[model samples]
Target chain A: MTKALWRRPEGMSVVFILLSGLILVFIFAPLLKTVTSSGPGTLWGTLLEQDVYTSILLTIYAAFIATLVGLFLGVPLAYILARRSFWGKGFLEGLIDIPIVIPHSAAGIALLFVFGQQFLFGRIFHGLGVDFVNTVAGVVIAMMFVSLPFLIDSAKDGFRGVDVRLEKVARTLGASAWQSFLRVSLPLAWRNIFSGSVMMWARGMSEFGAVLILAYHVPFMGHYPVADSILVADRFASFGLDSARPVTVLVILISLITFITLRTIACRGVRT
Target chain B: MIKIRALKVNLGDFWLEDINLDIEEGEYFIILGPTGAGKTVLLEALAGLYPISQGEIWSDGREISHLYPEKRGMGIVYQDQALFPHLSVKDNIAFGLKFMSYPREKVRERVDDMVGLLKISHLVERNPSTLSGGERQKVALARALATDPRVLLLDEPLSALDPETKEGLQGELRELHHRVKVTVIHVTHDFEEAVALGNRVAVLNEGQIVQVGTPDEVLRRPKSEFVAHFALSRNILSGRAGDGEDGYTMVDVGGIEIRAITELRDEVHLSLRPEDILISRQPLHSSARNSLSGVVADIIPRGAVIYVTVSLPLELTCLITRQSLEDLELRRGMKVWVTFKAGAVHVF
Candidate 1:
């Protein structure tokens, strides 16, 4: 009886495996079907198209610029959130996370109110010869506003993991506040910050709703500013599913390859 | 020299209140306390890590109450050995020197000197994560001392080590202090550690300094009941005191009358060190003022010594050697005589 019981599969384990397998299939089936549906010639033709390739490059470039902006502005805020306790700290954290929970298009509308030509900030930037409506800068701002929380939250967790005593020791060793942060805290938290930047970059590249509302045609090659998501949507809307399928497949393939490479680099960076 | 006058710090739930100390140059001073006694807080305050709510800290006649920690000329090492994980051990030792005006070669020389002095030269190339507890602590010490701060603050630097490792590091710390002649402020909850390392020890209870004196003075005559208990005096009894013959005050503990040399009267607490009491088969004529015959309650064998509790209506613990315990064949319920001199009793 004991031998038979040991040989039998546990009910819970079987059930768990079945449930997990179902989710895996649910996630991978559509992606595999979409890639396989397009032939190699069609994918190559889609990549060869000037509009398709330029839009893809524009999307990647805009996301990179947005990530740089996030790093410049978000790291200090992350450090503060991790280290110091003050009034309204919780409220401030909640405010940072509001973009993650709210609808991206709604967020874009909110951004437009602040950065539009008639608004206060928009007027100030306009004085500097920068216009937000239907520009590359608008696309970057939209991407950054939606994807900043990933970088900030990850960096905050990293900084929080460091022992405060290390900084105190550094201060006693003749390091100023900034020196200690640069030498000790920053080096220790670089991995988290790096991975977070990657996450923000990836999120920015895939952003559609916010970019659609903020800048449908972001200037790229020559005088035309066209976005990848907008082009795909336009093709589908004008020429149906069959016409847009190749470009969609090309975009997915490029994004997956870039995202996987970055993720691998991040994992290796953490290991070392 | 360092002097702290009326130093007060408020850390929300914990507060160090009205702390005062005068540490001499090159002196090995210890801050002794129980857990949550605000000992580390006091050390951090001295290091200028915490803002002083009220008080003055003067170093070499300069008031540094509001100075930044980096300007205070003090180096602190924590028990956790907070070595930067990303930096190699050599870089960790050379970390502070880089911030100084020293040239690159000078920084390297200073790092080398510290490594040699701490005998961590072999481990200099290794990561702190790969080091043993003792090695990590040595590296921490080397890192702290490389900057040549005027004062060295060690917060339970040896508490996390095993007994053998702790003993080795304790010797190294003493030798290092002798060689460098920097004023050291060490904090620990272990009374034995304070006695072993400190030239002068200060006892902290709650948030206040209860007593400050030499190790002998603190051990022989603790000023407060809390100190007495913390110092490992096992027999603390509450009683009523009255005038007795020969200038000896008698205390009535439970139903027993114990004689002690004190001017205190009325209700009092008495601290009697276990080692001060003599346990024997029979009472003999001695210079001791108190002798009571009682039944042996328990015989607890600690390392090197045996603790025998005797109940003369009120139980009192006395320390005896293992040989004596065996030769006397002491067991539970055996009648024994416990005696101590009136001078051995500490009344508070």
Candidate 2:
């Protein structure tokens, strides 16, 4: 490391190295401190606790479902945004990103207006015996609301990178428009979509303010309640740092394992 | 045979208006033009990839103007060789066949045949990203040809390749065209490629079909100034035609009289190919009726060939081999004799 640093130009390297080191320390120091503060016994105990594991699983599962919903709705919009030109297209694209720019609590309030029990849509869904208030469905809706932009933007970039001529070539070769998209464009854009899904999923997992307003207690699958982030916050407030730190470490560990595995799978067949 | 009558397309800023063409069956037709001349646009229109704003297209005596590209029964190869990056070479070739719902065995047979024909059997299992440019081009061609479409449209397919790979593919294309007998409409900005591969060539300039004729006619007898410029006809001089001895016509071009073996009216336009002019130290007693002594004003080396511009009473450009440039010891300001046969002078 010393030899590599010495090989860099001395004058510019000093400032460059100093600034990069600052950023590196800024990000890593907090994470290192958090990991070291939690004891192994506490981590093991949190893992074995039924509520802790259930809440963590509920967060990931809700986020996964939200990502799946995003894939279904966002990919078509992404493709259209990438390939077509029309009036208000730029405005429409910007609209998709509004969830990201706005505060999550504000997003929850907006969603509550639409999904709240007294409102028209809320009453309609409530009549169907599917209530969003304090339910897993509400949790998914909140996650989807706040984390959808990552999937749509990444997918749009992926679709834009594909040459339109490739589709034309496919059409000329007796492949229909649908076939071309399935066999050529989708496979070509899969890596990006996968990465985008992972990002959306991670963002959804970390969501607190929106999920808190939307669904603090998830009556998940008509069974035991699961509330990961809110439970951690409650524990920190009432039972102090030791009680919450173990759950925080557990969430980080599970997220890292899941994120790394999905990333490895997503990396396959990616264009060089 | 394919006939395009008054076809017009509006693709945002660049548009083609009233474009007409007739590509005969089993003929290697070439669309010659410069970049942004709407050559690819015309080809795409023929393939039904783009909607024509007006007029119609009839292929094999049937109107297919509004058909979808997949139903048009045409294959196209783009300049960048857009092979599917996610698929192996064999899978890329087999892609079109999949939509046809052919049996597994038949698809394998056809894929193997194309792989064998293109000499890419070794690369069948390799992804397109791992292949070289020429390899990818061959795979793209194989994929397009696998469907056995009625007409093959090539959009500057050879422009991206190096000289050696291009030359090799050009020969392979010629051989494939002969053996397969598929109707081809190749679009290119390179005049030499058109001259080499085209039975009939169309010159497109700014979305209009300026001229369409055989390669010899397009090269030697361009009908418009655009064609003259696009064909790189350096010598386009207007002259007064006068009667010459022994049933020959003489044109006085800026006080320099050039002889041609043709009858002409009072005035004429002449085009002389630069490569046809022979440069020598002295005028020889040859059958060439025209000979002029001029001082070499400029010598520019373009790859293997050198363009020697001579300032006669009228300026003339002569293309000569690099070895000849050295053998004759030609340089700027040296006087040299340029000779050409009377038949070589194209009088219009």
Candidate 3:
């Protein structure tokens, strides 16, 4: 009788539905609680604050720039990882995922050694009128350092999914290597790359440890250097939990909306 | 015309060595080999897809062994029909023409011409993912031909299709070649396909060219033991050869003496095709030089033909129709007579 019940579709579906319901509730309960805890007036008031709005905008802009840079730099490496087999390939692949495994603050310190004012790259950029210490560039570099693995790994899987024969066929059809990549490989891998970019952007937005160590006050509006996470941390430290909650709720609401919008666009793009 | 001189390719685990061939202009040449025989590798080498460790490829009096695949002016079609899935059928057909820097109107005209030629007009607007296997292959062919390549390379283009579809495409390929008059280098393992399509067939074994001849020459007069086995000559016997009566060479197989028409003396290998051997219940009065009476040792039925193995001190498998099997009431352990003409025996 137990075996028969196990084989029944309704019995199996009931267990699946119950387990899935637990995960959905677990994910939504905290968001729902926080969103409802704040009054509408307080949420609107937080949204209207210049410091809050500007810092949120700054965070979004920095993450967007970081994502674009990651796309530009990571895709070629991803394609190479996907297509070629050589000595130390495994070591190189593991190196790409190192940021994900290490602590974010540790990752920040590691980034600092290279991008700090005293380092070679930092000194070079400093000489070029671009400063990395306590600047927007530092924030973007920190975000990119922590979240680039998502983009590279996803893009590598995307390129791996595309058959190499397609590229070979394109070559035979009078397309140069670069042309084939643009016409065939890139387009075929667009969906994965787009999703990876979104993931990297989202991860960059929520980053606190790395951003705090690298750029505590990211310059914005050509005046102040205050990022969203840094501002929220400051509010909580000085004015306590109630002062921090409104801005936190505002940031969450904006991020959730943007992420959903991007995800929906990706899904529609796949369908059509 | 294309000529390959001492072409050698080293693919680490698999390699092609000392390969030489002269493919004439406007000929449907076949590179025939079994699986893992490096047929695709040789074709890829010709198309400049693989780096040749040593060799020269001359096409139309121009050396092209070092040219890039795109600059070689050759198109290749694979068995899987690697059409760009992101593009529509029309776009896939026009992909190469776009790279050639043709004007928009010329590209449109060329795409239309290709679609009309391949009879894929209705499928022009559809995505490649939605097409059938045969339809996808047709689109791949059209895409390759749109560039007006000097030589067309086909890597087992019909091997992936169902038998009926394969036959239909084979006929279309012949017709297409005739209409387009493009020099084709088609690779396949099927002897029947080679015979039906190839102007001349080059048999490859273990990365080396074993024999190059017309299909009949390769099939009837295989120069090596590998070719004899690979060509499906089921009855191969190693024996001593000596002069016999009526200008025939008598081959001593074990204790059985079989007469063959050959000048090869001493030890020799003879191949007799199963279809050439006739089976009967009694000895027939005919001009066939060799006849042996034996008991039917085994009876195996394949698709439409049955293999009847007779033991006359040596096992000889002969192919007969199902109707013949039923008419003769042949069964295992039944006595039977096997006979074939001396001319049917091929000695090497």
Candidate 4:
């Protein structure tokens, strides 16, 4: 049988192709079964319960606010980083990626230090009566800090996708700098920016540590707080570590749908 | 009228210095320069895309050095046919007429007229990228013309097209300028395109205006060495001065004498375009001032233009017409007398 397979030239390459295919199937089947069984309705009634619904809704809303800020703020920063030349630019780029590299528990403690009522920014927000230390706004700020670079870097790639010649031609035809940018540069770069926003929102929705540090009481009340949050000034922060946060489960579902939809529409990944 | 004085720019690899010239109202001015000589930069500066470090540009008696491109009242077409890809040919032609200062309703009328003038009416609704190279060039030219700009600057406009298309568009360009009477400054490298379309030619080399005059004067009489070679003169000879009437000098060619007029030096260089020289198998009595006997070295056929090189005793090359080919029974190694008028022998 081995001699017969080798003797036929066209039949030889087919055996190795099937072997690699069988290996991929061997690796993926059990992993897929584990995920499929643990999905929304299968494990517990937390999937459709009212308390679960509230946690899921709050996560989505907070993620949305952070993503909106990322869309307007991070995109322009990303585009500038991609297009312009300046001293200390590499340092600035490294700063944007800092949140991704830091430990999540450490990120939570960092968020509390600056956002506590004793801090200057916390006092300013306290005067506005919109509390950041224990509200949805605190949750969003935490998500924004961790997930912003994804939005900006992706948007920068989008803006760089447009040809500079098209803008030059527009200028010669009487289009001003801002006018040319709005007309020639923006429309061509829209899709990539949209995909970047989707990715940022998905990342933000899945954030738990920073939000737990700043606003643990929103999800847990006077329970055993996570050890790091207990060290912070915020009360009841110890409850988070063992509280079984429902928002994480809801965030996972929303992100799964979002990932599928965006991947289909974005078609190609943003090129750096 | 368009006038540029001492235009200078140092754009790294490409440089231009001391470029100076003026085209009268309704004149077709062509600037001929090789690639990377800052020709496009000069045109772009006039159109206000780049800052001219030192120079003054005037259009219609107004100094427009500091004005905006649209305010400068100039239209420029690039070699790439840089039409707006998103717009139809009709809209591309009408693109510039929508400034807050310009009339919107008047745009359509002008676009229609210019498109019809360029005979691109059928392509009015087509996207610019869909059009052929020739069609795109006409659209670009039409777009530039539609605004009724003070002057039109074409940067190597036809050099991008096929031969047949370039010649056809060349004729259309001459007619377009004649009918519109818009002062034009066309930049090109093709000598025939320059001669065919230029009311005046400015020969640019290494960033300087080497020579500028009417087609007959510049082609027949170039002032510099590079200009003589670039205009593709057949023979440039050194001769000791010989005296003639009307302050003309009879230049001493080796073993033969030819007469020409000059305001130049005693040791002068005489330029003769290949087409100006006539070839005959037998030496004959003629009105031409000087004739020399030589052997035919080679025959070169250049599309509608035939180059017959007659190897004179002093390695002289004479260009004759295709129609005169059979009349003179010209062939390689055939002994012939290359005859040219003394006045036609330009000394500079």
Per DockQ, the best of the predicted structures is 1
Sort the candidates on TM-score, descending order.
1, 3, 2, 4
**lDDT, each prediction:** 0.92, 0.88, 0.92, 0.75
Ranking by lDDT: 3, 1, 2, 4
Candidate 4 or 1, higher lDDT = 1
Candidate 4: regions farther than 4 A off: A1-31, A49-67, A74-163, A199-253, A266-272, B101-111, B238-258, B321-323, B326-331
DockQ of every candidate: 0.89, 0.72, 0.79, 0.32
lDDT of 3 by residue, B243-292 (tens): 99989999999989999999899999999989999999999889999999
**Cand. 4 Cα-lDDT:** 0.75
What is candidate 1's TM-score against the reference?
0.96
lDDT of 1 by residue, A1-272 (tens): 45644577889999999999999999999999999999999899888888888888888999999999999999999999999999999999999999999999998899899999999999999999998888999989989999999999999998998899999999999999999999989988888898899999989988888888888876777646466777888899999999899988988898899889888887784554
> Which candidate gets the maximum TM-score versus the true structure?
1
C-alpha positional error of residue A104 in candidate 2 after TM-score superposition, expressed in Å: 0.9
Prediction 4 TM-score vs. true: 0.78
Show the lowest summed lDDT stretch of 10 residues, model 1 chain A.
A1-10
TM-score of chain B of each: 0.97, 0.93, 0.97, 0.91
Candidate 4 backbone collisions, by pair: A224-A238, A224-A239, A225-A237, A225-A238, A225-A239, A226-A238, B242-B250, B274-B319
How does each model score on TM-score? Answer: 0.96, 0.90, 0.95, 0.78
Stretches off by above 4 angstroms in model 3 are A1-17, A269-272
Q: What lDDT score goes with residue A56 in model 2?
A: 84
Candidate 4 or 1, higher TM-score: 1
For candidate 4, the docking band is: acceptable
TM-score of chain A of each: 0.93, 0.92, 0.92, 0.73
lDDT of 3 by residue, A138-210 (tens): 8898899989999999999999999998998999999999999999999999888988999899988888888
